[model samples]
Target: MREPHRTDSATATRDTRPVPCRPADARRTVRHAVAERCRDRALTCAGQALDDALLVTSELTTNAILHGGGITGFDVAVDSGGVRVSVSDRSDDVPVATARPDEPDRCAAGGRGWPIVCRLARDVRVACLPCGGKCITAVVPLR
Candidate 1:
């Protein structure tokens, strides 16, 4: 006679809760998410995609710290297609328009983080939070 196997949904499910991280700490959180999510899966170009993900993570959090009065919330979700990163902060100003590179006078005050983020992310979105801030979501494709 064989004993029956047990399945634990609570233990198996990944916690989908929002993780509050400092600007510098978000990257590590992403790295861990990527590693855990990619453990069994295989992607031929994961290296470059991972780099892009990390860069995007750095830019969002750094921008929050520098311009948005620090990060309020952060979350990362890794799937077979890509990694989705959401960074929330305390600001209402638009990231791209406010710091458009074509306008040298205003652009010179900021670094290249926004442009880099826009270029690397497959899909990017920004939404105003009801609590008086904004959230930026960027999805970097793994393929």
Candidate 2:
């Protein structure tokens, strides 16, 4: 199992807090827990934003697998302000969001993922860490 990266408290303030979560199925349960926190805090309306959060997590995870080589684990953190989803993968390659002008259909699925993530999330960040790995995080504002 891969270990979570260590960072200072100052950095952690802006990060997803690097929670240990299973890369596969457990991510769903973890996401649900975060969504529930959002709900309990009254940060969002409940259903729609939770769906959006899940979708963003799915895209980030898929990007980790397809472009960042593969992932061993991921994290989801929620506060009163927003929801942060981060997927840690084995490659340092940065993910670029691109849509071909001529072939609009080229992004029908795989490529469209980033676009959706960008639109739904208030902020998006892609980090290529020095240690031959990457973390893509999306911050979706509550309500």
Candidate 3:
């Protein structure tokens, strides 16, 4: 099993304080937190659901870093319902799913992650923070 990276907090599930600078860090944080907190719950146990959650995590964090200026806050919480991953960045503009790669106008390298996130996450929300930027929360139900 992978050990959760500790920062100001003593454990992974409790260490929601770090603002991940990279997508991998955010994904790791989500993985550890969700795995630790939701292991006993049948619907929250690890499997394809966990993989979907990680993919959503990657997309959100990568988008934040690439388009939202930078990640200002990151957090994850696990419950009987599912794992909720929230990522806040400096862009007030909301995320939009663009055209597919095969589309004539869409950029080939990008525009795919957002749709993947939308598809995998059961509930997706984008809220503009009062301070600045926006926070995207995605809940991926484990099965």
Candidate 4:
């Protein structure tokens, strides 16, 4: 398992690194990174929040692979209240949340990723990078 590169500042501790764009590998890598960082920071990672964070990480990384062309970077930060997960991709298009269709036949083949991420994380944000890419961040509170 690869560990995240840690950087310490006055305000907070951040572990940021780049993860591969492959779906299966990216999901596993992100989960491992989150778990390891949480452990190192003495943060709780053995409850509903951990589960939710892992799920959100998986969904976000998968979305990057499927929709964002590829993942360019990833970061997990330990904040005062919670941990923030940021996944950057080469595509600048932000994600949109759409309600699930009542009829299965009317539903699109895909589009549930952002909703799932929003539901799992306490907060979510998207920032457009200077390189014309975008980074989607989700924060999961420790409980």
Tens-place lDDT digits, model 2, residues 30-52: 46656567455555536777778
Instruction: Assess each prediction's global lDDT (C-alpha) against the native.
Output: 0.75, 0.65, 0.78, 0.72
Clashing pairs in 3: none
Estimate, for each residue in 1-143, the C-alpha lDDT of model 1 and write its tens digit. 11121324332212254555664578777877777666645444358898999999999998998999888878777775577788888888879634455675763656689999999999888888877888898889877
Clashes of each: 0, 0, 0, 0
**Best by the lDDT measure:** 3
Q: Which model, 1 or 4, shows the larger TM-score?
A: 1
Q: How good is model 2 by TM-score?
A: 0.71
**Native-to-model Cα distance after best TM-score fit, residue 48 in candidate 4, in Å:** 1.3
Looking at model 1, residue 34 earns an lDDT score of 76
Model 1: ten consecutive residues of lowest lDDT = 1-10
Error of 3 at 51 (Å): 0.3
Q: Write the per-residue lDDT of candidate 3 for residues 1-143, one digit (tens) a residue.
A: 11232233322244355788999998888878876765444344677988888999999999999999999888887765567788889999898876565888655678888889999999988888877888888888866
Score residue 70 of candidate 4 by CA lDDT: 79
| Candidate 2 displacement at residue 1 in angstroms | 20
The number of the candidate with the highest TM-score is: 3
TM-score rank order? 3, 1, 4, 2
- Please, what are the lDDT tens digits per residue for candidate 4 over residues 1-143? 12332445543456544566565565556566556666666766667876777778888888888888878888766555566777888888888876766547655567777888888788888888887788888888767
